[model samples]
Target: MIRRRTLLGAAALAALATGAFAQDDKTKVGFIYVGPVGDGGWSYEHNQGRLAVEEHFGDKVETVYQESVPEGADAERVMTQMALSGADLIFTTSFGYMDPTMNVAAKFPDVKFEHATGYKTAENVSNYSARFYEGRAVQGLIAGRMTKSNKIGYIASFPIPEVIRGINAAYLAAKKVNPDVEFNVVWAFTWFDPAKEADAAKALIEQGADVVLQHTDSTAPQAAAAEAGNVITFGQASDMGEYAPMPRVSSIIDNWAPYYIDRVQAVMDGTWESKSTWDGIAPGMVEIGEISDAVPADVKAEALALKDAIASGETHPFTGPINKQDGSAWLVEGETADDGTLAGMDFYVEGLSGDIPN
Candidate 1:
């Protein structure tokens, strides 16, 4: 009887140990951010998505992130550390991190990687981005109508296709509504430099641009617009409602939570695969914030109608009759731009002056 009881206790102990190990099998997700999570713009929104993942998974998953990480060698090192530390999946949230992600992914085949705003993929890496140009169209409509000086200022980050597409979309929309509108674009060459962004805004304001738009990730422009007074601005990535009713007339919000959650779930379920995703307003990836009371009621309604049209597929922002910066016809009347053309957009549309910096 003593021998039998001892054997039963040992069996029960083995079962409990197995059960504990199974329960502790948590999925680990990691994120690499280009800017501080408190930037109140792009990185902030991405961090919010990270938080959403935590809320969704509870104890079933563990998430880690390294913010303010620069894009080159530093990014590779950070990713290597994460992979070595047992991260099942990682997200590198910047266009500049594309090559770094690919490099790290090649070394760690079992680790999944997701890169934002880029066009590269591997067996272990996927690319995803929002169609931000769609939202820029709406901002352009408002900027064109609201500008008292008829000179709209554009604070550009890098001259990549994504930023160029935004410039072209905004210019097309503005020129469509206000034929006399002109764009004064300043490429800051940096993504989240508040000082540079502020200087750019002030310079544009000095040059008589009463309306400002930004492709960079910071609220400094809005603040600059506020200090200058009588200038209208729009929020980027996140809804900077703090400056609303005057400088911040409207915004383009990036909703990343749903995508992050879906991808994490895929990794957890062992169904993860490499693919590209480019979502826009139609799928709720891009959102237009409130058109403030500062804008005329008629104009607000018009912008809302345009947003709805874009979301419903009733209108394409890049419809032709558009010309290149050199005055060469690029799009025929009533013709819409193809994804191939848009993805590799490198020239400025006619009516906008200045060359894209290499």
Candidate 2:
């Protein structure tokens, strides 16, 4: 009877040890997206990164995501639930989730948090973003050369620094190539609203804008531009290749998979830390999608040259003799914008009409 009891006790201990080892071997990664995974833009690219994490880690890692999570109270609640469910690391893939991410990080000090396109960080939270402005400079070169009309339009999302930087960089490049070019800006306020994005594109087309650029996360503007017949547009975030060769002459592709894999690896190895990372073309974080044949051969060559210059550090997108919207000198000749100024960019550069909206 004593021998039987000893055998059962040893088996129970082994089972508990195996269970603990299993838990220790696996890491749970979570994601919070501001739009649907099918948006085919920002959220879609982020989701692709999430899938990359799963692919790279396989049985060692599990990923969970909540899509179309609106910023604000809902975001906080969703993040809380993710942390409560044993997520080892969570990525909040939106600028508006900055505050909520901090709040959740404070409550769950053990869980690591990464917020995209945001500056705020805590002991447990890290911020990351791509220098999308580099890609925008290439788009602007294409837009300026391709526009039959001197008028170009921009469909802006929120007035965040990231969006504003894209606008300024594109405008600067366009202005460099076409001195007579003018920008008509329209603020959509929402990041992923298809109807609103389409309406803004239509409005720009009606106003003689032959070239349209958007910071919003939808292909609706491309559709609108396609319907407008003579208009040209560029893809945002992901390549909306369906409209290629015409509406989407070229694109700004956000490549987040490599970075996502690296961060997940760090978490798995217990080496993750709260750090800020802003990568651009040089690191392959921001890719300029193929410029279609619809663009003149010479123009395409020039755009590619500009991309190379930016990547090689031979050119700075925000280099001056640039001015603020009020026509005040912002960067003197031979001067370049610092990371501090660019990260908190709130004003439009000179030649871009209207206010940035509060």
Candidate 3:
């Protein structure tokens, strides 16, 4: 009887050891979102990437996330907790989380961090963003051609370089297509406020804007446009296609799965390094969604051609003969804007009214 008990005890110990080893072998990834995963826009797309990671790695990886995390002290706290909880890699998916991501990364030197739509980097942190302005150019062309009022509405988020670049790119393309086109920008200042976004869209529509573009997340703008009728919109950050063929025509879909999978693989291979990645349609980072049947066949053809040109490097969205809002020559004819200027873009291009908020 004593001999049999000893053998059973040995078997139990061995099983426990194997279980612990299995748990330790899995690479754990963390994500901090600024909005709920079901927002059907930015965070939703990010969550899709996370799901993709899980699906790809199977039992080799573990993923965790905290949705709707505010981008200040709360974000830092979440990052710290995730790090403490054995997160090998954490992706902070919002521009506002930049400073907080840096702060948390300093304390957890072993853990890798990735920030989206930000420009900061450190030894343990990397930054990445899509060239969304490329998509905006296509949207602008469609808007210019589709709008009866010749007045386009833009629902802007914060006045960051990313937002500013989008507004400029859209305006430039629209103005090129329709010389009489005008842009009415309403700054919502928040990334995913449904009510605020809806209000902004309504106000624009009321002000004679027959078309709307947004840099903010959430499908509220699309819904608002649908309700307003005769107003068209483009999906922001994700394909909010439920309102398609009318209010929501085309979209700029953020495809983060490839990047996320690559980064996580780096962690598992012990080859993770900090670097910035800014890719657009060419590399499949930013995708232009389907142009709906509502768009005229000619305009749709032109938009697709523009997409192909941008992807093939045959077109630069900020091609020259452009001026700053103050009427200063920013780019001479045939002189495309450099990466430096576009990265740190702050001022509005010529023909855009009102000042960028402080």
Candidate 4:
């Protein structure tokens, strides 16, 4: 009896030691998402990056995430809870979460924070975004050339620089290829509302738009276009290949795996630092999904060439001889737009109608 009790006590001590080691070995990483992972777009792509971190690190890291988190005070609450729950690193995947992330990071200086599509940063916070406009340029070219009605529709999310840049890039590229191209812009305010997005697409289609591009997340636009039976669409943020060949001719894929893994590794190695990262096609941060055979052979070839040129630094989407919507010259002849201007882009290029909502 005495021997059995001693053995049981020894086993208990061994188990406790093992549990402690396992706990210490794990680096807890948390993610705050603005939409559900199954939204099939922005948040979905971001979640893919989170999954990549888990796969890359395996047992060395533990990850937690909260989906459909609103970007205001709720975001702050979620982030604070994550930090208090022992999160070593937290990624707030939304532009509107910038302030909340900052507020939470200030209280927990030891915890690292990464805010997506936002410009603010702090001692413990960093910002990162993809130059989606590059992909939009390619989509614009396709939309311009393929439209039968000479009207292209853009479903914009917010009136921020990111969405605005996408609009201008697509418009300029489309207008370049098809001089008769006219763009109709619709602001849908919400990023992931399918009902609003679908209604916006329907309204554009009714207005004679045959080619539709979206800066918002969700497959509703694609569904609306597909249901209409003659419209062409491009995927946003994710491949969304389920609707390929017709409506979804191509896509702007956000590849966050490499960045996510690198950052998580930095945390593990004590090399993590607060910095801003903006990367695009050249670095494989933004990828143009496969162009379907539905596009005219010549158009597809030209689009591929343009993509290669952009990737090779031989072409800048916002090249000179461009003007603001008010007819003021924005870029002089042969002058390409600089990063500073692009980062804070607000005005639309000449020939685009309507005012940016305040």
RMSD values, in order shown: 10.8, 9.8, 9.4, 9.2
Question: What is the C-alpha local distance difference test score of each model?
Answer: 0.91, 0.90, 0.91, 0.91
Clashing pairs in 4: none
Candidate 1 lDDT by residue in tens digits, 1-358: 4564445444433433433333237898888888889998999999999999999999988888877777777678778877777788999999999999999999999999999999989999999999999999999999888887999999999989999999999999999999999999999999999999999999999999999999889899999999999999999999999999889999999999999999999998899999999899999999999999999999999999999999999999999888999989999999999987888899999999888999
TM-score of each: 0.93, 0.93, 0.93, 0.93
Residues 1-358, model 3: lDDT tens digits: 4564444434433433443333476898989899889999999999999999999999999988878777676678777777777789999999999999999999999999999999999999999999999999999999989989999999999999999999999999999999999999999989989999999999999999999999889999899999999999999999998989888889999999999999999999999999999999999999999999999899999999999999999999999999999999999999999988898999999999999997
Q: Over all chains combined, what TM-score does candidate 2 have?
A: 0.93
lDDT of 2 by residue, 1-358 (tens): 4564445434433433433333454798889899999998999999999998899889889887877777876678778877776789999999999999999999999999999999998988999999999999999999999988889999999999999999999999999999999999899999999999999999999989999999999999999999999889999999889899888999999999999999999998889999999999999999999899899999999999999999999999999899999989899999999999999999999988888988
Local error of candidate 4 at 80, Å? Answer: 0.3
Model 4 score (lDDT): 0.91
Q: After superposition, how far is residue 312 of candidate 2 from its true place, in Å?
A: 0.8
Candidate 4 ranges with C-alpha deviation above 4 Å: 1-23
Clashes of each: 0, 0, 0, 0
TM-score, predicted candidate 4 vs. hidden true structure: 0.93
- What is candidate 4's lDDT per residue for 1-358, written digit by digit as tens? 4564445434433433433333465898888788889999999999999999999999999888877776676677677777776788999999999999989999999999999998989999999999899999999999999999999999998999999999999999999999999999999999999999999999999999999999889999999999998999999999989999998999999999999899999999999999999999999999999999889899999999989999999998999899999999999998999988998899999999998996
